[model samples]
Target: MFWVVAAASAVVLGVAATLAVVFWPKYPALAFQPLADPSRVAPAVPITSRFAAATVRGDRAYFASVSDDGTLGVVAADTGTGERLWGNPAAGDADDWQQLVALPDAVVAVSAEDDDRRRMVLLDPGSGKPLWDRVIGDDDTLLYAEDTVVLVDREEDRLLGLDVRGQGRVRWELKDPGSLSGSRTTTVLAATTPEDLAAPTSAKGAPFAEPLDDDRRIVQIGADRSARVIDARTGAVLVPPRQSVADPDDPVVAHDGTLVVAESDNARRIVAYDLAKLGEPRVLYTAPDDNTRFEHLTPCGTDRVCAVQTTSSDAKTAQVVAVDVAEGGRRWAWPLPDTNNLVPVGDSLLAAQNTTPAKVSLLGADGTVRWTRDGVAARLDGGNLLRFAKPLSTYTDDPSVAGEHLGDDAVELGPLSGVRPATCAWNTAVLACVADEDFVLRRFAG
Candidate 1:
């Protein structure tokens, strides 16, 4: 009887040990660590208001609150103390604060005054006090901003550089600048017509959508196909305007401090001209064959640019080839046929697949595929790796985001089961999401 009792006890202990080993927390190294909880700050947004949007600037998180009275309020929350301030920082009494853009020390809130006029308000991060308010044309868009200058498209025909420090004053205006959008990391923006911004087939769409290697110079193209590179900071013309572009296939791209334009005489040849002197066109890359074409010319790393080469044959194969900008030769090639976008996260690359199920791969600096996750949609936003279990559908489903710092081995992004990440906004410092009409702020420890 003693022996039987001992054997039963040992069996129960063994089973418990096995369960613990198998059920250990997974993805603990790939997630975010929340610094606050619901009980601390409780809800970041008030219960009386619906959480419309949220953004993080500096050390504070801003929330857009919509009340039943049909008024929108900009609320601030202290990330350090988990304190949601009562001051609703705003300028005009616009009905909707449609967008919030975070800068170094201020937050810019854009609201539509009417169908013909749009208002932009720059607010202080601490007290939500108004620093500047400017009413722009309805056709104008807040294209790109850096430091103190906010670049905008004026009346769909010009570039307006507004000084944030000067209360949205027009520091510089470039008339007839054509359609120009700013790059995220670089000042080199593609100059195109207003119509090309909406059409991809025109070879003028998504110029500012990709990251650039440098920001010292900006590339501007005219409607007449003339291209030039200018000083990004001062808007001083560096390369004289020349009809250097070939056709729709060969566009002028600012890369590696050089103007990468196609040889005007030979549409098939591509060259890079140094910004110091537009002396001679250095051969950067050329068409591998007539049947293959390159798409999405992006800067993958320092002194390196990559493009997706797709074969037009029956097989329809695609591969990414990285070009050594210095050597003017191929560095490495990786076969990722259905690649949707090659997003640069710090020094690594987050390769997203355009397939139905969505295969996401984290590629190392040397083009090595470190890890790949299937059946999940992924995005690099605010320099954070955001992921969804399935395709996000706001109409039919409530999608949640599981995110983490791209380079760190952090596991999970706080406790985000009830939060809506689609409407959430994040920066390098903080993440703000909504849960059941309230705002949820999650911070990361560096």
Candidate 2:
């Protein structure tokens, strides 16, 4: 009887050890070490009325709030110390401050007064002083690049480019309606001329490769499924409409100025075109089987692109493929099972698996698993940091908390107090998010 009891005791101990090894990492305190003291959290900012949008740039956080009196105000606060930088109640009325875009030295706010009138106002980032204001037609769509802003007037079918820093000076304008597509830093506009419009195939069979300055051209796709490279400054048609089977899935500009498009030809493939060389499309990697389709492509680093390839009929069979942008070959591929969300964090990929006890995995650019954790909601803050969230309590009054960190082995920032439904904007850093409970914008940093 004594021998039998000893053997049973050993089995129970072994099971307990195994369970600890598997589940202990889920505890927030063990997986993450708090970077900021919970007791030292910043005071909440009062936003009693309607909150439209917010942006964080550099060291300041800017947000727009509407009061009970129907007046609109833009407020700026320091992210680190939570100090108010400036607040402009009369900058624009509630009807006038509909959209806000943050620039390096200024903030551009858009207002639609009526169906026929729209206003674009550029204000000093530090002082909220009006730098310049321009009234555009209601049919126009405003787009921004780092140094330039563009207005696409769909009704007038005109494309206007203006210098963001200058006094709203026109850089270039073209008459094209549906052929404008590019990143925020670059603009590509395309359309057939009146003569070419009558015979849209006039410029067909054009070669895809031509030597042109990438800095001066934006590659656009036409309604007829043709590719055209347009001059960025002079509005010249650098590469006229060319016949191609490429469909823009997710186009990204590589470090060397090559426009990489995740497209489908005979099979889903990644194609790279040097806007400078405009040569033959370099086939990067073709999907291994007909079942796989490339869904998204983002820059992994300076010289590689990361693509999420999913099976057509199964959500569980998804994988990430990292390809060398210069060599047009695969560097590594990692399988992500039951993953419903994928985003790029720094040079890595964050995959959120849709399983019970929810798991998150971080993958390096070389397809190695850096770390995996469970029991949190996460998203990339448009930078190198991972923002995590967990429900504070089951009661309605209990806030849903969030924090941001580098996602390394031993880094954690928040589980910031009194924050719920937080939204973050990312450039080189994750901007602070305004807490829905108190409307206080909290910044998380390591």
RMSD of each: 12.2, 15.0
lDDT of 2 at 248: 36
Q: Which ten residues in a row have the lowest lDDT in candidate 2?
A: 199-208
lDDT of 2 by residue, 1-446 (tens): 99899999999999999998998542122123343332122222334434445665656667665554545566677766667777776455535446666766567777755667877778788887777778877656664444666676555555677776677788887765234542222224322111111110100111111122224445655434556666655556676666562543334443346667777655567888766556788888887777777755656655677867788837678777888878878999888877655555446666667777667777876788887766443432323344444422222232233343444343455455543333333222223444443235443443
User: Which lDDT tens digits does candidate 1 get at residues 13-112?
Assistant: 9999999889843222333554445412333224343326666554566766555443556767776665777456345456555676656556777775
| Candidate 1 vs. true structure, TM-score | 0.69
lDDT for 411 in candidate 2 is 49
Q: After superposition, how far is residue 244 of candidate 1 from its true place, in Å?
A: 2.2
Q: What is the alpha-carbon lDDT of model 2 when measured against the actual structure?
A: 0.55
Q: Clash pairs of candidate 2? A: 209-278, 209-279, 210-278, 216-232
- Tell me, by TM-score, which candidate is best: 1
Query: Per-prediction TM-score, please?
Result: 0.69, 0.67
* Model 2, runs deviating above 4 Å: 1-49, 68-70, 94-99, 110-120, 132-142, 167-169, 177-218, 229-242, 248-255, 338-341, 353-359, 374-384, 391-408, 424-431, 436-446
State how far residue 154 of model 1 sits from its true place (Å): 4.9
